[model samples]
Target chain A: MRIALDAMGGDFAPDAIVKGAIMAAREIDEATSLLLIGKEDVVNSLLKEYGYTGNKIAVVNATQVIEMGEHPTKALTHKTDSSIAIGFGLLKMQQADAFCSAGNTGAMLVGAMFSVKAIEGILRPSIANFVPKLKGGYGVILDVGANAECKPEVLEQFGELGSIYAKYVLGIDNPKVGLMNLGEEEGKGTVVVQAAYQRLKANGNINFIGNIEGRDLFNDKADVIVCDGYTGNIILKMAESLYDVLHEKGISDPFFDKFNYEAEGGSPILGVNGNVVIGHGVSSPTAVKNMVLQAQKMVSSKIWERFKKNYNE
Target chain B: MRIALDAMGGDFAPDAIVKGAIMAAREIDEATSLLLIGKEDVVNSLLKEYGYTGNKIAVVNATQVIEMGEHPTKALTHKTDSSIAIGFGLLKMQQADAFCSAGNTGAMLVGAMFSVKAIEGILRPSIANFVPKLKGGYGVILDVGANAECKPEVLEQFGELGSIYAKYVLGIDNPKVGLMNLGEEEGKGTVVVQAAYQRLKANGNINFIGNIEGRDLFNDKADVIVCDGYTGNIILKMAESLYDVLHEKGISDPFFDKFNYEAEGGSPILGVNGNVVIGHGVSSPTAVKNMVLQAQKMVSSKIWERFKKNYNE
Candidate 1:
């Protein structure tokens, strides 16, 4: 399996990315290789400075660099030779098994849509983040910031997308999908949520486990939490902050430590044509390494193939 | 000042409420009194059993009771002599300075609307919960579960209502109000939130800070967080569960300890004709005690009067 990484993404771009590749090289199996995409000389020099002498790693050149703050559509359109653009080009052409970026989140999302594209029957592709469950393992939460205002059908689709990712990528057996809402009642929540509840319950493709409140995010009630991007984004950020608060206070339990973004790795773009993950913009070397490992799992599970089978077949 | 509490409300009912009243009696000043409204004989016996000889607490008769699962509107109308109804009646007739309950949340909200009523010009009354800040003190978040779907104008009004509550009741001067969104950018979030941003910024009544994200809940970015009840309820429950998770793990910190609902007391109803608070259905004696004191603070601050003054004449 080959995982193509954007060498010029995130706050600490080429340096951290190169360092991360060095770390991941030792961990990945001999069959898996890292294709580091960036300005060739800069990346090569950084790799040399990092003292990376491994057969599992290689560098690919993309002359231009897309800054973290650039607009997604415009940047991807104009900067065709940028690392992000080139990374997608590699994935679209099937040259790389999977692609990962910690760069502009918007650009990563836009590139996935334009290149690998959404699954044929999929209404909209979603960004799925991991929620650290108290009992053990992580639950998948979708549309973290993809579609802020999702229609009922879009939300229902998230349930399906999240479930497939959970069962395959995360290894949850028959993942229970729950709609995020204020209340647990069948008729409770906003119009969109209420409608989505009925649709989820009626849908036979996923294990629909009624409505789960915000309090249920960390519980074992659901392995796949479905919601509009607005609610999911807020919950994801809040959980991330909890980890920060605990770490700052010098308090770290194994379960609470899992709340760390680095612990869960990067959030994946589900329902796209390929395995793609978007790491935090401030991703550390460890976080990047974890993200690479996460991509390896996505590739090994053949998640996009499963999504295609589920939705397209 | 006279504060009326529903003794027959909450899961523990007359026992916890009566015990809570006795606890409040010792903490309350000579100027403040608690009118425990419930089955007169039951409440009086429980108060005596608890060995309360304080003159601060007195029993008031409420023959009927509103069960926790009953529909709010029907329960209020059919059970006219219910503890919640009688408590609201006392507030409406100016016989009590405030009313509070841990019974069916919907019943409390409905009774507030029918009895004391929403302030003349207020679009909707909101239930405001306290968020424990990392620095110190608490920030007020409004519309927790009152109005699940709020318009841009209603959200703008929440900014005003929350600012008033934060300033007067919580004793924060020049409270910073923020619209909760997926991103800190101006155009981020759902359509309603986008529209609310413009209105909150334009409305000179509030100290409108720009949008704050989920991570800012405990930060000093905004002292009063404004969002629709759907969003607020989810955030409130999620925060409460954080306290639950931490407590179960036997981890306690001054800041995280404040996440306990008992520490924050109860959610107060804002932008109403009179001060009203709704406690958790499974409220413990300590939670009920804190709730009574919260009612005392509301009465002392005269929050409803300020709401009326701001929204009405």
Candidate 2:
């Protein structure tokens, strides 16, 4: 299996990304291949600085880097030689089994959609993250920020996709799917959420657990929680901010520490044709290394293929 | 000022509610009068347990109590002698200067709407809460669970109400108002937020500070944050859950403590005809006491009158 790394895409550019790639190449299965995409000299210099001579690690040259502030589509279209574009190109050409980046999220999403494309029967892609609840169980929150405005049908699709992710990737059997609503009652949310709840409840393909309020998210009420991108994004960010503030205050707790992983490591772009992981912009080497491993797990688990099959079925 | 306390409301009703009323009667200097509404015997027993003998504290007979699980309208309408109904009646008859309760939120909102009613020019009343940011400044997140679906004009009114509350209640002069969106750009949110942004930006009544994303909510970007009740409720609950989980895990931080005020004490029903504060269902005596003080402040400041005048102007 081969993974393409956008070495120049994140805030901690070449150095951290290169080091993480080397670390993953060294520790991961010997059969795994690592292809780092960035400016040739910068990548080589970092590799040399780390004294990385592993045969699994290789460098591919790309001249430009997508700045975090640049417009995603504009940057992708204008910077043809950018690391993200070239890495995505490699994934499209089957040179890489998976694509991973801790870069501009919008740019990564745009590039993934344009390059790797979406799975058949999938209307839109979503970003899914695991929120560690206090009960030692994790809930999957989807469409973190992919499409801000989603139709009721799209939310139902997210429920299905999130359930499958929890079942296969997270190793939870018969994952319970829930529609995030303002209240727990059958008719408690907006028009979109109400419609989505009805559809989700009728969906026999998964364990539909009915509507769940935001407070229920911290418990073991549901394994997979799905909502429109806007609400999901707000929830995910609020959780992230909470963890951050707690971590910064030196409040050491095992539950919160579980969420201390680099932002980029755990977020996977779902509904794409292939495995694509997006990390936090300020990811550390440890986070990048973990992301590579996460991608490998997704590839081995055949998550996308399962999604495609279920979607077709 | 005469205040009606729902002795049968909240998780710690009668005990905490009676103790808080006694405290308010003894400490508050506004010629306070308390009409404790609940099962007369139970309320009297709890008051005797606390050894309260203040002339200001009185008991009004109410036979039924609204449970958290019951529907608000059905419970209020059917249980004519319920504490919530009696409290509303006190307000409607002008026998009490204000009504305070830590009961079912839906019922409280329903009773407030039916009894106190909305002031003219007010489309709908909203609930606001304080969300602490990383920089130690608090943001007023409004419409936490009032109106589920909101139009652009309604959001504009929320912006106005939130700004006034921030300026007078929280004492943030020239408070910056933000329209909650998925992104910070003017064209970043859903149709509702986008149109509201345009209207807010054009309106001279508020200090409209463009759109703010979920992540920026913790960064002290704006003093008053406005969103539809659906999104606001989700965010509020999510934040509350975070605080709960962190507090449970022994994550000590000033933010959690700062926001630990009882909902019964601090949640004033904005845009209502008179001073009505809805506390959280799990409010303790301290929170109830604080809410009474909050009501006193609103009364002294003539918050309702000021809102009416400014809304018209």
Candidate 3:
């Protein structure tokens, strides 16, 4: 399996991305190849600086880089030869098994959706993250800013998607899925959540754990938590803020350390036709390395195959 | 000033409630009195157990208790003579300057709406809380589950209310108010939030700092953050979960320790006709004492008077 890396994305750009690619190419098996996509001279210069020499690692020269502040659609349409577009195009053409980028999140999302397209039965692609709770395990929150306005059925789909991820990627069997609501009672949320709760509860394919409030997210009350992109995005961002604040205040723990790995691993764009991971814009070399490894694991686990089966069923 | 306490509310009921009332009465000057509302015999018995000799804490007989599981409206209607109802009734009759309770949140909210009534010029009363962020000051989040559906105007009002609290109550001069959105850009949120952002930005009365996303809530981006109750509640709960999870994982910090105060200090019912506070049903004695102190401060600061003046302006 080969993975395409957008070397011109993120704050550290070519240097961190090139180093991460070289590290992964060396550590990963021979069958796992790496394609570094970026401006030819810049990427080549970084590769030479690192003194990297390996058959597994290759470079694809592109001429443009999209700034973080540029409009995603406008830039993608205008800068057709940019590193992000070229990398995603490569994945679309089956030249690479997966594409990973620590770039403009909006642009990455747009490019992935436009190029790779959504899964057959998916309404909208969602993003998932493992936020460590007060309890021993991490709570998985989905749709963390993919589709802001969601229907009831959309949330139910997130439940299915989140459940599979928790079980396969996070290594939890029979992961408990909870619908995010204002209260724990059966009818304690907005009209959208209430409808989704009923549908999720009736779906026997998932380990539906019923409704859970925000406070219950970190209390080991459930493993997989599903919500609309709006609420999910808010929760994820707020948690990120809390972690930063607590860490700065000398709160020492594994959870806070996780915050230090700001770009440790990027969010997987679930429901897409291909393996596409969107890393943080500020991601460093270590984060790029982790994201690359995460992509490799996801491919090995055949997460897409499981997603297809579950979605169809 | 006299404040009525619901002695039969909360997880530790009579004991904690009665003790909290006594503590408040002792801490505050003789000019402040507490009317403990509950079963006369039970309250008197608990008061004796604590060996309270203060006459400032008086007991008003109440025969009914609202359970957490019961419906707020139904419980209030059925148990007209309950502590929660009677406590609100005291405020309605001008017998008490304010009311405090660590009881069924929904029940207290319903009772306060009926008895205390919303202040003129205020659309609806919102529940607000202080989230300790990475910055030295806290982020004031409003509408944490009060009104599920909100208009653009209501969101703007929340921003104004949050700004006032952060400035006057928390002592932050010229508090920066941020309209909660999906992104920090001008047109990055829901239709309602977008419209509200424009109004807040144009309004000369408020220190509108523009839009802020969820990730910025803890990064000192804004002192006062405002959103509808549904979104606000989700953010507040998520933050609470993060703090709890981090703390449980032995993440030691003096900042988080301050949250140890119970929900008994209750939420100050913003946009109300008078000073009214509602605590969580699981509040501890310390929370109740804090709520009592909060009530006194609200009264002395003439928050209502200032609100009316600002509304006219």
Candidate 4:
């Protein structure tokens, strides 16, 4: 298995990305190899500077860089030789099993949709972030910023997509899907959410656990929570802030520590034809390493294939 | 000052409410008195059983009771003698300085709208919940479970309303108002949110701080956070859950303890003609006591008159 990573993506870029890759190399499966996509000279020199003498890490030349502030589509179109563009190029050509980045989130999303594209029957590709469950495992929440707004149909699709990911990648059996809303009652939510609740309940492919409130996030009620991108994004950032606050206060717990983004590293773009993960822009070495392992899990599970089969077959 | 409370409301009912009233009578301002509304016989017996001999606690007879599951509008209409109905009646008649309840949330909202109603020029009344900032003092977020969806103008109004509450009641000076969104960029978030951002920025009455993300909830970015009811409700519940989880784990901290509903006691209904607060349905005696004290604060601040002046003047 080959995992293509954007070494020139994050705030720390080559420095943190390279160091994280070295750490991940020590623990990653022997069958898996790392493809570091960036300016070949910069990545290699950094690797040498970091005192890395490992054979598992290789540099793939990409001449241009997509700065974090650049427009996603514009950068992708103009900087064809950028690390992100090249990483997606490798995935589309089957040269890499998965592609991961800690750079531009919008670019990673646009790259996934434009290059490998959504599956045949998928209405829209969604971004799914991992939810740290109170019982010591992770659940998935989708549409976490991909589509600021989603139709009832799109939300229903997220339920199925999140369910597939949870069951296959996270290995949760018959995962319970819950719609995040203001209240648990069937009729209690915005017009769109109320409609989405009905659609999720009608669908039979996954276990629909009715509606779950925000308080149910860390509980054992639902393994897969579905909401529009606007809501999901807020929840994700809020939980991340909780970790920041707790850590700042020197209040550390086994469960609260999971609130740290570095614990899971990256969010996956589901329903796309290939495996893709987008890490935090300020990702540290540990975060980048975990992002790589998350991608490894996604590739090994063949989640994209399951999505395709769920829709096409 | 007379503060009317629904003695028959909440899961604990007359027992906890009576006991809570007794506790609140001790700490409450000597000028303020409690009007406990419920079945006269039952409430008096409970008051006697709880050994409350305080002259500040008075009982008003209400023959009926509104159960938690009853429809808000229907119960208020048919059960005129219900404790919730009588509480609203006293507020509408100006016989009570403020009214508070640990009862059905829907009923509380319905009662506020049906009785004293929204202040003149107020588009919609909103429910505002206290935010436990990472620092020391508290902030306020509005439209929590009151209006599931809000228009751009309604959101702008929330900004002003919350600003008033924070400054006048919470004691924040020149309180900053922020529109909650998926991203901090002015162009980000759903269409309604984007438009709301524009309206908030254009409005000259309040100190608009532009858009704030979920991570900024506890930060010093904005003392008054504005959002549609759906988002605010989710955030409020999620924060409540955080407190519950921490308390259950026996992990106590000054900041986390503030997350408890008992700390603030109830969410105030802003933009209404009268001061009103709705407490948690399962409120403990401490929570009930705090609820009464919160109502006292609202009455003393004369927040409803301030709302009238803001819009009517």
Candidates in order, TM-scores: namely 0.99, 0.95, 0.95, 0.99
Q: Enumerate the chain B TM-scores of all models.
A: 0.98, 0.92, 0.93, 0.99
Could you give candidate 3's per-residue lDDT for residues B125-219 as a string of tens digits? 88887766554656678888988768888888888888887777777889889887777778876677788988898878789989888778766
lDDT-wise, the better of 1 and 4 is 4
Candidate 3, residue B198: how far the Cα is off, in Å: 2.2
lDDT of 2 by residue, A3-31 (tens): 99999978888788998898788767778
lDDT of 1 by residue, A229-249 (tens): 998999999989988999999
Lowest-sum lDDT 10-residue window in model 3 chain B? B257-266
Q: Pick out the ten consecutive residues of candidate 1 chain A with the lowest summed lDDT.
A: A258-267
* Interface C-alpha root-mean-square deviation, candidates in order: 0.7, 1.3, 1.6, 0.5
Residue pairs in collision within model 1: none
Point out where model 2 deviates above 4 Å.
Answer: A261-266, B133-137, B261-266
Question: A1-313, model 4: which lDDT tens digit per residue?
Answer: 9999999999998899999999998889999999999999999999999889989998999999999999999999999999999999999999999999999999998999899998999998999998989888999999889998999999999999999899999999999999999999899999999999889999988899999999999999999999999999999999999889889889899999999999989999999999999999999999999999999999999999999999998
Ordered from best to worst DockQ, the candidate numbers read 4, 1, 2, 3
Candidate 3 chain A, poorest ten consecutive residues by summed lDDT: A255-264
* Whole-model lDDT values for every prediction: 0.91, 0.84, 0.81, 0.93
Clashes of each: 0, 7, 4, 0
Clashing pairs in 3: A134-B245, A245-B134, B266-B278, B266-B279
Indicate the residue-level lDDT of B13 in model 1.
90
lDDT of 4: 0.93
Report the TM-score of candidate 3, chain B only. 0.93
